[model samples]
Target: MFSYNSALMKHKKIHKGEKEFICLQCGKRYRRRIDLAYHVRIHTGEKPFKCLVCGKTFCFKSSLTSHERLHRREKPFGCLECGKNFSQNIHLACHMRIHTGEKPFKCLECGNRFGQSRTLANHMKIHTGEKPFRCLQCGKSFRQTANLSSHMRIHTGEKPFKCLQCGKSFRQRGHLASHVRTHTGEKPFSCLECGKSFSRGSNLARHMQSHRGEKPFKCSHCGKSFCERSKLRTRQQIHPG
Candidate 1:
């Protein structure tokens, strides 16, 4: 058994690209002999570490230890700011950004920032115009895989997000969140000029236009402008009742 300090030293060798041990079955190189032994089990299909509670078998002792935590219902990693618990340290680290407002990941094209690497990757697709995720049912393509998954629910008639208060279901979680605000009477968005709060950010933005007298919304039929988009939409008969 290697000590904690010895294990750290051995792990550093991997980052340095120093492979001391080689796998006999696959010719894969490993810095530590323990790691080489663990790799060999993949070829042999050997799971020596067994869970006493669930009877689940794992190839590595470390994997077994992590699995046992699930049975114990223990979340070792916790956020200090929110009191939220996570199964892994990486998840807890990601959660910390919510309180810190630290956006480490940034887009190279637009210089837009995001807290998570996955969000930055998704934003890159907007600039690239790469819609790889395709729906088989409708043959519609989406930039994000999550959008395609949500689209599939339309064909399946699956309303996953249910409102606890009114029992009304929504297709998307954001819609459910907005629906929840209606029940709670939570108006998070506020106009800076008038100090009047609104439930949605778009409502606040439209209200701000009134103070500035900026008529961005134009009617295509008459070339008439209005401070609020709702006014132009109403005149054009385009606004849904």
Candidate 2:
């Protein structure tokens, strides 16, 4: 019943970016008058669409329609690579990047790539030293949100990373690797000063600081000092006099 000539004319009009529907209240324009009317309800808080099953209300009919699909267990969008189903097309599009390795989001300063815009925004915080994500366990903060999520596990005593060799669980991959080196006697980090090697860089750094007599750790109470901060705290607790 649709004419080819009429369809072509409609396509041309759409390409021209014509604003036929204009909102009288805010002077905002839309392609369709129904969409403009739906947007105007945001300012009025006029929820016209109501759900019968759960008694949920929505301002727009389209939102109510999408909400109804949740009860029906309908997933219209399916990922071609993983066969994973998504309720919305936007989620499906984002999932596709995992297979394609297409990083559209890029950091302006560091030129680092990310699949999501939010990840790229978070990466920028590292350069700025903005610790937005905080750990409730030790009151420690990190620039990245993922680091905060990982830090929360420390409070919960959740060691998710497991080693297959010894069937041991660790809070972090670095900790697990250091534990494995102890079993294997693998000292990867070498000290240039004493020709002594350590399994971890942290141990080597601590050992080197002892050789240099670099007692950076200071006591808050009586101006006492130690090579390590933990040693200073321990000494302070023992000799409070």
Candidate 3:
């Protein structure tokens, strides 16, 4: 009866947030020492979870379970709005925000909202003018670490994105998208005044400035006005000639 009572007490203690187990090896205490013992195995890379289907071993049972799901193709959690399913509940929760228009993550600096906290944190740098990520090659700075990583490829001359239509390679996806538009001749953005269409939004915005007479870029030499910076350069070249 004492052994049975001890076993029941040990089980109840975990539920009641009791740290009964202490590791002699690391001097770490755990509520259920079994959990501490299991964690210690992580440092040693001791994987006990074995898959019966393929005889594969995993460091954790949860990892093994996720791996098993991949083999089974079982996606129990699904987005009700889009019919897109996910293996995890957290992923489904994130996906649901797209349909519900829920932006819980907000930038404190500019009040910019994002679906994810990491994205909001990244956006906040734009308001603060903080570029933490720097390129080693050109000393150029970027707001996001991914942008710095992508810029490093410029030094290496690595063009990962390739146009399937023209066989041209580009460093950025936006550049690839613009190149592909040239092949398709799809000008989605159009000027309201002239009805002239452009493949890119920035190009359309620059075109609209022509009708509005908006010269955002001014020449430093003579303060000459021009719709686009390229046109301003052309005017500057004529001055030299």
Q: What's the TM-score of every candidate structure?
A: 0.68, 0.50, 0.65
**Whole-model Cα lDDT of every candidate shown, in order:** 0.89, 0.85, 0.85
Which ranges of candidate 1 are over 4 A from the true structure? 1-31, 35-73, 211-216, 237-241
- Candidate 3's C-alpha runs over 4 A off are 1-87, 191-196, 219-222
Model 2: lDDT equals: 0.85
- Tell me the tens digit of each residue's lDDT in model 3 across 108-215: 666778898777888877778999988877889999988997889878999999999879999998889988999899999998897999999999999988888899
Model 2 bad stretches (over 4 Å): 1-16, 20-28, 40-76, 160-241
Best by lDDT: 1
**Candidate 3 TM-score over all chains jointly:** 0.65
Worst 10 residues of 2 by lDDT: 1-10
Error of 2 at 218 (Å): 22
Residue 170's lDDT within candidate 1 is 91
List RMSD in Å for every model shown: 5.8, 7.9, 5.8
lDDT of 1: 0.89
Error of 3 at 137 (Å): 3.1
